[model samples]
Target: MSCQHAPSSDGNPTEADSLVIKVVETSAAGKQLSELTKFTASGADVVEITIKPNETYQTITGFGGSFTEASAYLLNQLSPDNRQRILEAYFGDAGARYSLTRTHINS
Candidate 1:
């Protein structure tokens, strides 16, 4: 995954500020929350976005993952040591850091 935060230019700040955007990308090829350095646009590569931070649209209570029977089975297939390593890699401070979970699995 990749993230790009548009420059903030709020000389005269207000609820209506510049429409900043951050883009993150992830790929099965192994990318995980990787940020993009630049964007090479085509002749007509254009889009529109509106940012309204003050608006009350939806609220995100939390973020988390699900545990299924199949997942449990696969996890049990691994040795205890290997399983611990995988757990840490996904929920440890040095890793992805999820919610109650720490995670960067796709940060």
Candidate 2:
């Protein structure tokens, strides 16, 4: 489904959200296995796996690579255990990363 772009209270068009995913599979069997596992796992009430693709261009435009780089830098500054946990939670096997695009006006 496509999200709508609307004006906020400040009379500016809101950000645009979209994603295009291309799953990487080594073989046909692997593809089948991945799809099957994902479908079957969804039967449970809780979430099992969540993957979100990043829009490199849009993201770089919104927040420069330095921002993300700095974030990783800060995370690296944490203790080994804490960094591991934070990295796991943020860029774990099952996490979603979203990209937002919009234009802001300066008053």
Candidate 3:
């Protein structure tokens, strides 16, 4: 089914409330959340959705990178073993290299 939009129950019900969503898909065949580009759905099977856009209660805002001191502080707050595990996870070959510096740290 193809959905265009739906009426927002929080607001009033109307054609405008119908949520016209941009459809995308991810597949093992290399479709990484790609839009359903040229496909169109019609007939009674066409679906609709509604959402209240302004209802978000909270959000996280930050830059993409560079919170170095913050990282050091949180890490130091952990116990010795916990901190070591965290450090290993960040710097180990099989883990994410979240370490900005090549040098190792001791706490």
Q: Report the lDDT tens digits of candidate 1 across residue range 53-94.
A: 777888876555755666767888999999998778767788
Models ranked on lDDT = 3, 1, 2
TM-score of 3: 0.30
Error of 1 at 17 (Å): 12
Q: Please, what are the lDDT tens digits per residue for candidate 3 over residues 1-107?
A: 24555446765676554344466888999988787854434588675543557778777452123436667789889999999897777676666755465323442
List ranges where model 1 is wrong by over 4 Å.
9-45, 100-107
* lDDT per residue as tens, model 2, 1-107: 12223445764343442223233344655444232222222245743223234324343433212235556568779999998776555445563332332333421
> Whole-model lDDT, candidate 3?
0.62
**In model 3, which runs have C-alpha deviations exceeding 4 angstroms?**
1-67, 102-107
Which window of 10 residues has the lowest lDDT sum in candidate 3?
Answer: 98-107
> Distance (Å) between predicted and true CA of 12, model 1?
6.9
Indicate the worst ten consecutive residues by lDDT in candidate 1. 11-20
Task: Give the candidates in order of TM-score, highest first.
Answer: 1, 3, 2
C-alpha root-mean-square deviation, candidate 2: 17.3
- Provide the clashing-pair count of each candidate structure: 14, 0, 7
Question: Candidate 1, after superposition: displacement of residue 50 in Å?
Answer: 2.3
lDDT agreement with native, every candidate: 0.61, 0.43, 0.62
